[model samples]
Target: MSRKRKETEVFSLSFLDCICCGFGAVLLLFVLTASRKADQMDDLQSKIMAVIGDMEYEISLKDKEIERKKATLAVETRLAKDSGARLDETKKRRTELEDMLKLLLQQLAAIEGELGKLIDEKENMPTQEEKVPIPIPNPDRRQYLTGFDILGNQVLFLVEASGGMTADTLVDAAEWADKPEKERREAPKWKRVKKALKWMIANLKEGSNYKIIFFNKELVPLEVGFGRDWFDPMDPDLTVEVLNAIDDITPEGGANLEKAFAIVNELPIEPDRLVLICDGLPTLSDSYAGGGNQVMYDDRVAMLRAAQNALKLNLPVNTIMYPLMPDPGSAVHYWRLANSSDGSMISPSEGWPDI
Candidate 1:
């Protein structure tokens, strides 16, 4: 009944409970360690994935760079090919030019040999017709000008095919202007001018090229057909064609010397020398002046303009002045033109054939 004190026992429930609690704490510690290890592994895996993504991005940039380099290489190769083609073309052209030069040299040698033979034949036994060696007014090895001493490889004839060419006086010029084409064609002065032209053509060298331009109010070429500007007098058929063409032409318009010289300015290739066979100063400039004691002031002004234009050609202007009776001033102006341009003035005696 005392039950005052519970006796201390060696094995008690409290002690057992303490042992069990210690065991539970050990199990909890083991689980926490396993969880911590798993968490560390996950973090390492995330870092590795990020590194792989960066490496993939670098590889993509490298591929793009390689593509760009390939494109640049392709362009360079194309340019190189184009340059090679141009070089090949240049070489071919050079070869062709060399061949042409060789051919030209051979031809020149042959021509020289023929010329020597002609000289020998001419010296040894002159023919009856060759006895009076055509008096070349200004004999030169390079050219055969109609009236002047100047020589040239190429020659142009600027003939005044105007109504004034048919007569010696303005009254007659007006009268002839009213005449029919058939009658005007047979004028005495016109015939003489034509004869002189024939003589010049006959005396030209066999291979010489010439062009005849007739200017009145406008310019008229000897041959208007395509590819037929210069004439070869050596060809008998061509000579007849030119002669007939001249015969067909009739003097009817007022003389326009300005237009005549302007034709020279417009030539595709300038001649070495020019022979202007004009009667007087310009009567018709860009416009016409009625025949009534022709104004000399305007004529001189127009002639000055023509002379200045002619000077631009930088070649000798061998003037063959026709006697336009009352105008000695014309002769003076022509002389000044010749002197300024380093040319000669030849006034044929009386008529055309006299020269």
Candidate 2:
């Protein structure tokens, strides 16, 4: 037994070497895995840092944009406030100007009133010599001269008794045209026309022979059937009759100056002067054969020119024009006619011949 124990060994060299090699291999694997993990952590940390840096830059840019918007808002607010102030100033200036205009109008009205009073005083003043005394029927009544010589031995008055004479405007005339004859005769314009005729009759020169022919589509003498006779202005009965007849007449139909002037040819004596009392130019003529209910402006003018040719005698034409709406050309034409005929054209004031 002693001899067998002496030769036996507890461990061998190959087994120890195997154990050491296994330990070395495990250590190497651990070192390699640790190095790879450390490298991956470093890369992740770098990516995280770059992301944070970019987010911080974006936030800074947003802050700068907010500041710029705030600045723009401030500038716009300032401009709006300035514009509002200027608008208020402009409104205030406009108000002041309007007030000034109103004040000026008032002053002008006052001045005009004073001027009217002065004119009235001058007209009412007594004259030393009475060459052609303009007779005032009433002492309190005011009368105005026609501003032309009305001195003629034989005077003829051609009054237009057209529908237009019933009113100042065409619309009103149309309205009145459909009214009753009595109502039409009582129209304000018609009454004024009657007053004008009465005033002229009252102011006629002493010993003068006068004839009145009222014409529309037809010619009508003051006294029917006396179209060719002249009445003495001094005959009080005839004057009253003539006035009464004029008052009774109702204005109707269109004005026919051609027919009216043709009546002059039928007169026993040629008139020394012709007084035309009308609102506007003739709307009807014998020469116009055109078939239409309405008469155009140009047609009316042509009718007037044609009517002038009907006058055989070259007597002075004194026109006393009353206002008619849309008759602008009438004034110029009448004025030219008067100028050419060495006569006067008067558009009397509303208060003239204050009956």
Candidate 3:
């Protein structure tokens, strides 16, 4: 029995040793796998660090680019500001030019008046056998002045008081009003305007009633007076005052043409003379796109608003545009106004004559 027991014990011990050897082999294989895995993880970590470093460098480059753009933007902004200042200066000069023009207009009016008086006297004189009647120069030979001789008709001068007026027309009016009478007559303004005014004022006979009005977006009196003496066509003071007051004229803050038409409609006067002197078209009135340009409601709306208003007034409108621009309607509006009112013009059927 002892010998059998000893043999079984030896077998069991051999079995245990075999299992220990297998366990050792498995542990060795696990160590090899772990070492390979650790090597792969180290490589991946190196690759990730390289990529991260590259990303940081790329980010730094982008930051430098952003700084360059900022510097360029600053330079551009400064240049634009300088350019804007220059533009403002140019606009100021333009206004000065406009003032000079108005002075010229007033001077022309004075000259025309003197010429008209001389011409009338010359025409009335009897032709003698020896004496020849000097032919009077006709400033407006295209159409003879008419219906102006009818007295008691109120003269409502619808002067344009748009922003454009501030530039030239009105400033000259100030200079003309304050200037000497002789200078007013001798200047090119009166030299051109004298003849026209004289012919128009001729209608103001002994006891005629009249009133002079200046308007843009509102109605203002240059000089308000009535009666025959009031219509004295020989009012040098009046001429000067009108020319000066005209300098104060300005365009509408925003064109509400309805206001202008309403003013005329509510005047409660019959047989009136409405003169409209403007450069551009109507803007800011009630119409498509809000009367003028939505982006910029610059000039008056050149559309048919003026024409429609003229139709509503049922009266002739004398539109004198100063150096009208942008073609077609810019110049042609005058003709439309004249035709609508059953009136005719002499020269500058499109725009105004510089002289």
Candidate 4:
């Protein structure tokens, strides 16, 4: 009985020891699992904190944007004033430019006028410039003589289309009718006249009337236009036909000075002038049957009466004489004609020039 009781005690002690070992192993496993779970939780918390930090940064940026917008709106309220200030600056610049332009225009106009005056004075005093004299009407005379009516009432040309002149001389003469006094003086009278004519045609006023009368024996109209010679002298818009026709006048002649003068008598308006352009004394000037030897004066001089009869009740004659040689007879005729109706005479110097 004692041996059996001791055996039972030993078995009980072994069972208790086994139970303690199993419990210690389970406790150790539970501790390890709990520590792993705690580590995973800490990692999740770190991720959540990082996301929170990004969201805070975004929120701060949004706050800054709102403040910037508010500042922009505050500044925009006075847009009208800002725009007006800029506009005023622009307007001031424009005004200054306009004033400068106006001053420049005035200066240009003054210069052009001065040039015109200088051109006019050159005719009276001897100068190379072909400046025609400005004839102010003599109040004492019963005539309608006036200065270069810038209104160029007529484009009358007393051209010397005589066979004696070279083709080049005629061409040159035709082109120089409108030259300035200086240029005219620099060249021959014939060439100067041509230059002057060309100048006139190219620079005539818009409302001026013009007629180109070429004459040797009979008077011939070369170019004609109402208000403005051929085309506006100041501004030309010439037709090809007119330009060709103007350039087509050939130098041919029978030289009856009286015939050209007679053209004035047939004018609808009294007459501007009987521009007697002659390089020499008139050939066959009088009636052949009057005395057979000398030309008759009564018939030739009768033109004066006819001129006086046909002229505007009080228009004077004006003479521009071109002679190869300065003949006393031409001077006498020009002098007589000019004084006969209080006209003026323009003749070349004493030297004889080639045609």
Q: lDDT per model, in order?
A: 0.74, 0.81, 0.51, 0.53
Q: Candidate 1: which stretches are off by over 4 Å?
A: 1-147, 224-227, 287-294
RMSD each, Å: 15.7, 22.8, 21.9, 18.0
Model 4 earns a TM-score of 0.42
In model 1, the worst 10-residue window by lDDT is 141-150
Of 2 and 3, the candidate ahead on TM-score is 2
Model 1 residue pairs with clashes: none
Residues 177-226 of candidate 3: C-alpha lDDT, one tens digit per residue: 45554444454433333233333443355544444454444555555233
User: TM-score winner among the candidates?
Assistant: 2
Q: How does residue 283 of candidate 2 score in lDDT?
A: 89
What TM-score, over all chains together, does every model reach? Answer: 0.55, 0.58, 0.40, 0.42
The TM-score that candidate 3 achieves is: 0.40
**Model 2 residue 323 lDDT?**
68
Clashing pairs in 2: none
Q: Tell me the lDDT of model 4 at 299.
A: 41
Off by over 4 Å in 3: 1-152, 166-210, 221-244, 247-258, 286-303, 345-355
lDDT of 4 by residue, 251-325 (tens): 544455555555655656543433444554454332222344554445434433443344443444555556543
Q: What is the lDDT of residue 3 in candidate 1?
A: 67
